[model samples]
Target: MEIGAYQDAQFGQERTQERSEGSAGSMADLFPKLVAMQRLCGSTAFAVLSVHAHTLLKPGKIECTTQSPGSQEFVSPFLKLNTEFLLSHLCSSPCPVIFMPENAQAMDSSPACIVRNQAVTETSLAFPVQLGTLGNGFVMFFDARAMLSNDLLIDLHRKSLTVMREKLRLAFGMTTGSENLNDREIECLQLVGNGMKSEAIGEQLNLSVHTVNAYLGSATTKLNAVNRIQAIAKAIRLGIIA
Candidate 1:
């Protein structure tokens, strides 16, 4: 069925209520309908990516995905595209950005050109989701068939945002607390959460080991954490880091 059919159906009302109430909906509650919607939109696979505060272009984690084994091979290649540009565009606009394979081909000099020859889909769509202090993320739909109309794109964007907001609420509630971490402290905590040691994080950030430790220590104090590991865990729970 087309998107209009979905809008006319009872499921559409459910979506409306979900957005209106800001319910703490689970993936299990939304995934089935999302899969059906993707099928209607001619999307073969979809993924929700959580982006780090420091590394906006790099995904901190694949929160969830509907990619099959066959389509999994395309994921790495797809990510090689100009993500910095894509993310900047997302942050600038709330609409869906359509990416054609030819667009990838035009970037032959860049690593993004790799998708030109191997992409399985003729088109893809990306939607940006901003969760204020909680964080920011993206919802990507891959391998679409036809060009989507503006109304459908808008409806889909709203639905996608609804889904993401619910997921974020379930994943990270509004308990970020009064602890305000600076960019450097958050970066250090994020690195520690990813299992990076002080020396390694120092080298990566071009800071001295002492500086890294100082940042971690400051973050630990702000978080009221007794140690680095606890601080990392608290940061993750507080949505201070991915």
Candidate 2:
């Protein structure tokens, strides 16, 4: 995420440098790139929203930029840009948020309620972007046809997210830049997400159960999750594991 955030600023710099091409152009200037990134991520729709506040009652009014002109017509059915539960994550890390249909469907939690209440039935990725000078922004990718994962979407995600951040910062003003997770911690969480028990994860990683638990505990602490189940779920939501 640190790498992705850096890439965001770097990409933002490049785009700003090229802004002399057209000061008259609107956010539509980013349409083509949004379309390109949408294809790369296999998303049904891609949007960048500038968030003003992070309160439960007010998600802040959003200035949205989408791929196709008048595409909010297409996006309206799948998501409600402002909801209390959704706004809850804005004050957290500047990492990606993923909602897997299967995982989300099985979890009867507040977030699941938000997803269901909004009538979203597919996978989605949300990148929380906050720049000190620019306020707050969110870039969302919705893939309703199937479930999405970071492993398969990492390259696409990194590039797509970087470009969205740049486009948002340029279109909106302010420059930007998450948690620290080591390989072992991520590995253990991934296996746990795959429905593996700690012992099974240990066997797969060739580590003892105690070591696997330690890694899980460390990841949980880093993620500020309550338990292994919460850790795995948060890991999935944060794009730490597929």
Candidate 3:
């Protein structure tokens, strides 16, 4: 069947209603719901999992996982490479959420061949969800065979973002609008992870020493670190720097 045509029939309103009823509570709750949603949308298999400290994308560790049918053969090397590439690409996005379709080109064309040459027998999609304002990591994955409608895909993406946001809020004990950090603070923290000293960073960015210090200090406070070094370390642990 034509891809577009298939998407229309399978992703009609009834499917959306089925998906809407799926409640997402814990990782365990969400995973089954994802798998069920994929099935309802005509996919053979599906999985949804998240990573904590995703350093492969930045500096520290990240929590990520993918779920598929038990019958599917496990390919460790390809999975690792794919995960690495996904995280690296996600680092460039301002919004913490990323929806990556398997056969689609990356936004940044620099590493154009990351997945082009790989042999993918089954169709699949992956989502890279950055956990919190601190850059914790993501949860994602869907079935490509499902040929989910663009509207359905979009709905899932939006819902997934909401779930991740709520999870992070609870995990970090943050309230609405209380933990938002600006881009400058994030950039400064990333530079600190690269071992750039305050004065050097100031020169690199054409900012005054006092301004650089202020950025670092603000970042440190936001990250709940007592000092710059501690801030850097926390940033790394939180997957904010790389």
Compare the candidates by TM-score and give the number of the best one. Answer: 1
Model 2 segments more than 4 A misplaced: 1-29, 54-59, 67-70, 77-82, 102-118, 144-153, 172-242
Candidate 1 residue-wise lDDT, 1-242, digit = tens: 33345335423554455535645446587676567557757887776666554356755333334443355555566676545655565456444566676544332221111224344346776666665444466677778764465555656666766666566546654333313567789889888877898899999999999999999888888777799888776666544465
State each model's CA lDDT, in order.
0.61, 0.57, 0.52
Q: Which of 1 and 3 is the better model by lDDT?
A: 1
**Candidate 3 local lDDT, residue 100:** 36
> For residue 20, what is the lDDT in candidate 3?
54
Model 1 CA deviation exceeding 4 Å by range: 1-25, 55-71, 103-121, 173-242
158 Cα displacement, candidate 2 (Å): 3.0
| Candidate 1 TM-score over all chains jointly | 0.51
- Winner on TM-score between 1 and 3 is 1
**Lowest-lDDT window of 10 residues in candidate 2?**
107-116
**lDDT comparison, 2 vs 3, better candidate:** 2
Q: How well is each residue in 1-242 modelled by candidate 3, as lDDT tens digits?
A: 34344334433542354345533345455556566555645555544445444446765434335465552343343355466665565565422222333565444422111244345544444445554455434434433454444455545544554445445444555422224456678778778778788799889889988998898888888877788888766555443443
Per-residue lDDT for 80-174 in model 2, tens only? 54444345666654445666654455322211112332344566666665543343566677763443443334444445544544454355332
